[model samples]
Target: MPALLRIGRTLRRTLLQAIPTVLGIVILNFFLLQLAPGDAADVMAGEAGSATAESMAALRSRFGLDNPVLVQLGHYLNNLAHFSLGFSPRYGMPVADLIAQRLPGTLTLMAFALTIAILLGVILGSLMASFAGRIPDRLLSIFSLLFYSIPSFWIGLMLIVFFSVKLGWLPSGGAGTIGSRLTGLPAILDKARYMVLPATSLALFYVAIYARLTRASMLEVKNQDFVRTAYAKGLTPFGVTARHILRNALIPITTMAGMHIGGMLGGAVVVETVYSWPGLGRLAFEAVMGRDFTVLLGILLLSSLLVIIANAAVDIIHAWLDPRIGAR
Candidate 1:
């Protein structure tokens, strides 16, 4: 009960700290976007091939782009306080609605990629540590380095060529087939099939990172006195490694994984672009090209919130894994 209380307190404290952090990100993203060369009005006018000075002025007025920066910021914050994300001139929809349509795709991709990275990485790292300096270790190290060095977009493109064009085993792009109207298990399976390439491409780089990190951490932990004692107590090598070495080494892995969530979000931009995945990353890309700052700002704010939430979840997991963390 006391442990639960400690975890609860930790969660509350983390959330409390996050409020200001999210606000700061919101303000910073707003100002940073203001520095960009054009606004939605400029893009709209360009798309129309030409516009008179009066038309441009009216467009700016409509978007509130004619307002001073400080006044615009104040208006944005006010709308945020009312739970509004403003409207996307490019998409012709509310920012919140646009994000709602895309958020699930991004979340699903991130979840699959993270799961693949962690599971494959931990297993490979454990094997490499066990074999330390053997042929297996060297081979795995070389492969990990290769994966780490490759750009995700290139990996994505290669997957498309091999799997989609040559083997014809899976989809080359998209989240799912259009107008299929699939339901239940079939729908889920269809989505998973489409998800495979992009998820794997996004995951490969992180898998390399976690694999190397886990191998190094486990090697260090294996030399600790407690690990030696566990071995002395006649525990099987697997048992000792799993219970003592890997468990202790997981602290660093967990920390890195938490930090990597934001990076993964950034990488999704490239992966989504390559695969034509209908996620926020692609939406953000479109917004940038269209100079739709409102939509872009909304995406940034939501992304910041997601990172904060992920970190909080990591903290809770840490507290559970090491009770001392909660006590602290």
Candidate 2:
């Protein structure tokens, strides 16, 4: 089959598979959230200091929290079918709108972090493999281990102190400068500056993992028959390493990176919280705190969908990198 045709088939199959997967996630998340202590109504009432029994009942009814568990689930699923993520009583807005407002920031942060992790990781890992037991390899190994051991939030804090407080080179928190009307390149640059710390903090741990994985993978691939053939063909060391060894080693690294995308989303919660970045992570945190089940459910559903899409894209990339995999 043609490559594009195979890719189309794979995407179709993956998306079809994702339907039941997303539905299951939605159902499970709804039920699991039900096990929590209070609903949105209860949280609202509590925050208001006091409410009469009759008023509390009305509040429950207003938000549809008065329904039976199964009934509530049906309503939620129905709303989802209509592409309505339900309404956030806590925020007095549609869940979809809230998510729309925040999704870009989260995506930008995730992209920045992932890019950093992959590029730095591959370069460092390549160097380490080249050096093996030399001083360069030893120093990088120590650096990777140290970053790997430190928590992301602590890293964010330290970065904030050193870069934002002491050096005054970056903003300490948030997605951008507050109340700034800057546009064009200035606006883009402002956001980039604010993003550097949180993105770096989130990327550091994964960088360590990727670096170690890449080093091991490259070393293993270097000993392969194909690598030996390439070397024997009189290819320069750099040419053999880059075109033969590194290319083959990338399969495992790509798979691992794809799997970690979802994990990075989870990690963003802590990083976002630490930096006060206004993204889906921060929104999810707020939803949890305020017992905004509707918003929380929306976030969870969307997050799962994003992960699914990411994995599907990875499959396509894998197929492209190794046509035999596509033939499968």
CA RMSD, predictions in order: 1.0, 1.1
Cα-based lDDT at residue 277, candidate 1: 95
Off by over 4 Å in 1: none
Write down the lDDT of every candidate, Cα atoms only: 0.93, 0.93
Clashing pairs in 2: none
Per-residue C-alpha lDDT of model 1 across residues 1-328, encoded as one tens digit per residue:
8778878998999989998998999999988998899899999999998898899999889889999999999999999999999988778899999999999999999999999999999999999999999999999999999999999999999999999999999999998999999999999999999999999999999999999999999999989999889999999999999888988989889999999998888999999999999998998888999999999999999989888988998898888788788876
- Give a tens-digit lDDT track for model 2, residues 143-229: 999999999999999999999999999989988888999999999999999999999999999999999999999999988899889
TM-score per model over all chains: 0.98, 0.98
**Per-structure clash totals for the candidates:** 0, 0
Question: How well does candidate 2 score on lDDT at residue 121?
Answer: 97
Q: What lDDT does model 2 reach?
A: 0.93
